[model samples]
Target chain A: MELENSGRESVLQIALLGGVYNNYLALEATLQDASQRGCDEIYCLGDLGAFGPYPDRVFPLLDQYNVTCVQGNYDDSIGNGLDNCQCGYTDPRDNHFAQLSFDYTLANTSSGNRAYLRQLPKEIRLERYGLEILLCHGSPRRINEFLWESATSTQFLEYLGKQHQADIIVGTHTGIKWLRQLADQRWFCNSGVVGRPENDGATNVWYTILDIQTGHHGSSKRRALENVSWRHVPIHYDYRRLACEMEQEAIPTEFIETIRSGWWTTCLEVLPGKERRRGRF
Target chain B: MTTPKVSLTHLDQLWFQVAGTLCNLTCHHCFISCSPKNDSFGFLSLDQVRKHLDDSLIAGVKEYYFTGGEPFLNAEFVDILCLTLEYGPATVLTNGTVLKEEWVERLRKAESLSQYGLEFRVSIDGFSPESNDPIRGNGTFGRAMDGVLRLVDAGFLPIITAARTWPMEQDAEILDRFVQMLRDSGYAQPRLKILPTLQMGAEEQRTHGYLDSERLTDEMLTDFDFSQLVCDHSRIVTDRGVHVCPILIESPDSRLGETLSAACDDFPLSHGACMTCYQFGAICSNPSGQAYRVKSDEHGT
Candidate 1:
């Protein structure tokens, strides 16, 4: 990711893709959509491989599109040749599936890809449209932090921003997209992943488009929250092809079901009640 | 001769002993020996809870947890939880014996309104009545299961928390039976959290107290992750005052101070309960608890 700080008055639209999880099909669709939408820059909040087929396929596309990236828990683990994904799942069943996914992604990820992931920054702070946006995976504080929409408190997000000295923080590791604004100025956003469906029982996946538009009339340094318009852009992708390739690669059918049906068949324990209630389990 | 004391790294979770020692059903394995008559500890009113909630603002409490002999035994339990939802995500640990329909309905609405999750961790000792009733009490399983059904029907996925008093090897079989039972009983997605049984109070007589060697030593802290210990990131507010943890509420030494900030002092892990916590990682916290780990070393993100 670019460390350069560029300030501008013009509308800055950036696409944030979170946790590809090796779904190259969705990655392709998301990139094309972002391009057609005239996204100024596309950033991927790490975890490049997991759940889907051919972990290496998504790398070339990411390179072709010039997507700036942040290191996720999976990327850190795979890059360092760690034993586990370090998602900190406690449930026996959740651990069982996490291990399988980790092993597959790590084993299949190319050594060069691992090297590329290892060099990626943990956080990317870029000043755009007078707003300092900090892009990270999981959270600014911890790599594997699961900031679920329901489980995370606004005050806590505020603490992360205050502690980290960022006006706006964008993170994704929970696989769900949510944004909470403080005084309509500072914000915390989870760029929904393109890895798989959001466990919302829909075939379509999602990525986020942060549309930082016209700031409120003020001599104050901070921009108004109303100026920061963001949306979870739903992307309809070739999920069937992804699932077929996943089956061909002998990926877990449980994961394949999540891609096809959009309900998470695994990693349900980590979800809080509100998030879990939204899914079919 | 020195007892290992764990530092309060951060105020991640704040527990309110809402109902105190008052409970409708006296489980054989209750750590506090809470019964209908056990008024040794007392209820914390909504007013008292609000005060602590105010105090928690300064502490930056990430989550709010409600527990007791049975939290619903308190008259203002639902109101307390509703108020807590405004601040952060709230979780209530219930015996699954006394959760009323009106309360669940109200809580469901409160949860939907709040951005945070309202988690209900229901205590069900066993998968079957025969196994569960002997420990929890006769006919207690039916009532708890009823409560579970009520929560499920209300679109709340309550995590069925069971005590692993049996051998570790049997956990898989027992959990499988639990999932199968919940599925058979119309709960399609059953969330289960297995807890290590604390050998203290009623359980001490029912089973046995911890051995002298079970205590944590400073040497043990060499490379141990302090975040795994609830005392490192949590404090429970009882009517008496703020206690170090839910498990050692009965122990006088567990009382840190009157306020959450005053209770920031490191706790001496002198009791047997701390051993159980040391063996298990953050058992008191919800499953989502593992997400907030202490940042890794120099390679930290």
Candidate 2:
């Protein structure tokens, strides 16, 4: 993804999308929404294929919208023809569904697209208004790590910020959106996935918009931290269509159920107690 | 062959042997042979835990885990949990026999008030008393079930962690039965964590101990991701000192140092338990724990 900004503008609003998961319909709608909202840039934290059908469809939309992307675990696996999506679900039932999804996506993803995924940077570092923003699929330390909100400590996020040398760090892998501002004015954002609902018994998925007001010359760290604000924008797409498409592709019914009902069915094992309790499953 | 060595990648998980080797009920398969009389280790005071919590913050420890003979056996268990919830997510591993409704109620409230999760992992051996009582102890099953009900009533979804005492082939059937049993007990949405048995301590007498060959070797580490091993990313703080992991606390060599920083040095994976950890990655951690799925062949797909 393009990290270099042409100039330090007064205000910069960027759209951050997480794991599309082959949900081209959501991708299309999200692009339109982001454009209509007048976002200066759009970036997708990857996993461009999985769950939803027609793996190749997401690429054209991403290209059309110029959405910069970072490689996710699923993308890394698919791009390299790996045996499984490195999702870290240890349960046999979860692994069964994960494998099914991985095989389908790997078989369906075009060679060119796979190569594109293989080359996508694991992380993207951007300098905006004196703010060093780091975007990664999971935590910067590991590609497939699940940094769940309830389980992740503030100190840990701060450590990640310092370790990665970023004022603001954004990642999407746990499929839940959360924002935490650390004691040092550093920020961590998990831009929730558009691939599926957040298992919160809500059908709508989400993305995030980070608005940074950067015009003040020689802005202090406090001023820059204050200028940054993020909003989790719930994106409503044609769930019925995606579910039907998944059904047509013979994707597991449990996955389709998650798309329709917004509660995860297969990968419930990896959820932390609090996140699991929030889900209907 | 030389023993494989694993180093701490980061202090991701900091465990506390809170109640230490002092459990109310001594199970047949107690890995540490902890019992009412076995006070080889001692309970960590609230101040002690607070100190570790402070130390953990500097190390950027992701989550805190409290295990014991039974963490709830400690008088200040609830206070420790509540205090931990303020700093980060906390998970307590208990036998479920000693859980009080009042404690659960306070914990539920504490979790709600905090930004992090407070997980209660209740240990049970089997689906029914016939199977579980024999291992955990006679009459312990009923008491544990009562504790589970109390936890559920207090709005907590306690993860029922069962050691795989039965045959591996029976895993699916056993897990299904456990889920059904939990549901019957009024836990509508039951969460379960199935654990592989660690052959040590009292378990060595109850079942066969690890064979002489059961040890991690240097050759085994060639392609394996050491991160899967708990020692690669975790350390347990005991009243004695910070150890390599909770499973190997009894071993003298497991005591890496007295402080979290000193314990970050590499450890030789020579114990029989290291073989079990190699077989089952991150077995000591919650399923939601951080993991890196290293490809067996990094160069190949």
Best by lDDT: 2
Model 1 spans with C-alpha error above 4 angstroms: A1-9, A214-219, A224-226, B292-301
| Model 1 TM | 0.94
Listed per candidate, the RMSD to the true structure in angstroms reads: 3.4, 3.3
lDDT of 2 by residue, A94-144 (tens): 888888999999999999999998888888899887789999888877777
Predicted model with the maximum DockQ: 1
lDDT agreement of model 2 with the native: 0.87
lDDT of each: 0.86, 0.87
Q: Which 10 residues in a row give candidate 2 chain A its minimum summed lDDT?
A: A1-10
Q: Just chain B of model 2: what TM-score?
A: 0.96
| Model 2 agreement with the true structure over B1-301: per-residue lDDT tens digits | 7776886878889999999999999999989999999999999999999998999999999999999988888999899999999999999898888877778888899999999998888998999989999999999989998998898888788899999998999988888899999999889888888888999999999998999889878878776777778888899999999999999999999898888878888899888888998898878888888466545223111
Interface RMSD of 2: 3.1
CAPRI rating of model 2: medium
Clashes of 2: 0
Error of 2 at B272 (Å): 0.8
Per-candidate clash tally = 1, 0
